[model samples]
Target: MRVMELVRFGGADTAFATRELPQPVPGPGQVLVRVMATSVNPLDLQTRRGDYRDQVALPAVIGNDVSGVVVETGRGADDFQPGDEVWYLAPVFAGLGTYAEFHVVDQALVARKPARLSHVEAAGLALVGVTVWEALVERAGVRAGERVLVHGGAGGVGSAAIQIARALGAEVVTTARARDHGFVTGLGAGTAIDFSAGDYAPQVRAMGGVDVVLDTVGGDTLTRSPEILADRGRVVSIVDISEPQNLLAAWGVNATYHFVFVSPGRAKLEALGRLVDRGELRPVIGAVLPLADIAQAHTLLEGGSPTEGRGRPRGKIAIAVHPLDQPPHGTGSSGREE
Candidate 1:
């Protein structure tokens, strides 16, 4: 099997290397997947740069999301079988990842691919879907009719969060640059504010404030979200959470600040699959690159939304691990299985 791995922690191009390794067999309670597609996330970039090295073991195969076909099943793994199409979050530090042609993961963490989406979309959704699910549904306890503001609406997690919040009946508001307003609106955000051109806090207040704020961009954005919360409303971030006490005190709001790490879990993955199958949610794939061009993908992600001279991307960036013709079963037109 061929895998792209981070042999060292540093620059994207310098750390990632392609290596040939023996195909792995599934262990008990595990499934071996022939990876069809994988997507890049900020977490992948952070891992490559050693930002989480103290928490994640070194020499890691770093990708987090994968859409693939079950090639083999280990003993006690009765929930899945060979030839079943599946998608999952590969365990970050403790397990091998989806950056390779094949990956082995716990059967409990694998879910049947949504029958409506393609491999690329399925792969793109796993990590972001799980993160958003955990933050809004679990941590923030967002309810229908409640107002939710999602920061970084055009990014991977932001895009997924908007769709999930809308499906759950929440009035979704998101912040993106002016150019991405249409893209975020198309994903069902009721209000798309230009973060660069306007003040989100005041804009949110004019619309009855917000019950939940999902912050994908940290720094000042995360710091200011609490100010717009409607009393006991919550603020959850997948990135920086360094000033919880100060932010809470300054805002005078009952806030629940959270740092999201999308853990691999079977139940959540299955729930996400059901949502996709029902057409209530979809993964927005901004770009797709061949596996060999993963370095370029990382470069793009690291650069954030492209600047004026650089071509900008609209959604998640995916890397095709297998040939396009060999895409996993149940794939759909949107590059997702759902």
Candidate 2:
């Protein structure tokens, strides 16, 4: 099987390369998926650059999101048959990835793909959707009538968070640049603040301080979010919150800083699947590239040279792992690759 991998961590061009390896087989309670598509995330780049070397093992296959067909199912995996169409977020710390022709995932972490979406769209949702869902719904405990602020609203997780919050009846406000304000608003944000214009803290405060803050962009934004929180408001950040003590002390805030490490859970994937199948949510694909162009995909993800006339790609960039017509090995008709 053909796989993209990194022998060492460094530049995207230097670290990522294609190689041939033996196809993976399903182990007990696992399933071998013939990958149709996989999407890139910031974590992929970060891991590839040795940012998490102390934590993650070397020579890792570093993708987390996938939409694929089940080619084979192992013992104790009676729930999912060989032909089931599935999507999942791979466990990152364990280092089993989706950037290959086939990936073996625990059957407990897989869910049927949303009926309404293509494999491309489903692939794009696995990681970001789970991240947003966990942050807003699970950690922050966002309620229906609450005012929630989502920072970096145009990015993958931010975009998904906006739609999910709106669907749950939360009054959503997001920060984006001028060009993305309309896009964010169209996604159902109640208010879209242009971060480029000025500080977002005052604007959020004027709207009756937000009940929850979802900070996707950390650094200064994370530092400033606590200031705009309502009394006893919750703050969830996916990025590092460097000044947790200072921020909490100065603002009379009881902060719950979330360092989101998205886990693979079948129940969460099923929830997202139901939302997509019911037309309540949709995945945004910023660009599509062939498996051979994996390097270019990494470049766009790592803030490398521009593509599609934008300085950076807007949403998920997916890599098509297999052609649409082929039926993956070990499966019959229903396992046709998408």
Task: State the lDDT of candidate 2 residue by residue for 20-115, as single tens digits.
Answer: 778888889999988989998888887888888987776767788889888899988887887688899998867458888899988889999887
Q: Clashes in model 2: which pairs?
A: none
Question: What lDDT does the true structure give each of the candidates?
Answer: 0.83, 0.82
Q: Which candidate is the best by lDDT?
A: 1
| Tens-digit per-residue lDDT, 1-338, candidate 1 | 78887898888778878888788899999989888899998888888887888976766677879898888999999999887999898787777777888888889888898878888889999999999999999899889899999989998899999999998899999999989999999989999999899677888888888988887887786667667888888878788455543464435777667777768887888888888877888888888998888888888887743454555466799988886654432334222333
Task: List ranges where model 1 is wrong by over 4 Å.
Answer: 56-58, 242-245, 304-309, 326-338
- Once fitted onto the true fold, the runs of candidate 2 whose alpha carbons sit more than 4 angstroms away are 241-245, 249-251, 304-309, 325-338
Q: TM-score for every candidate vs. truth?
A: 0.91, 0.93
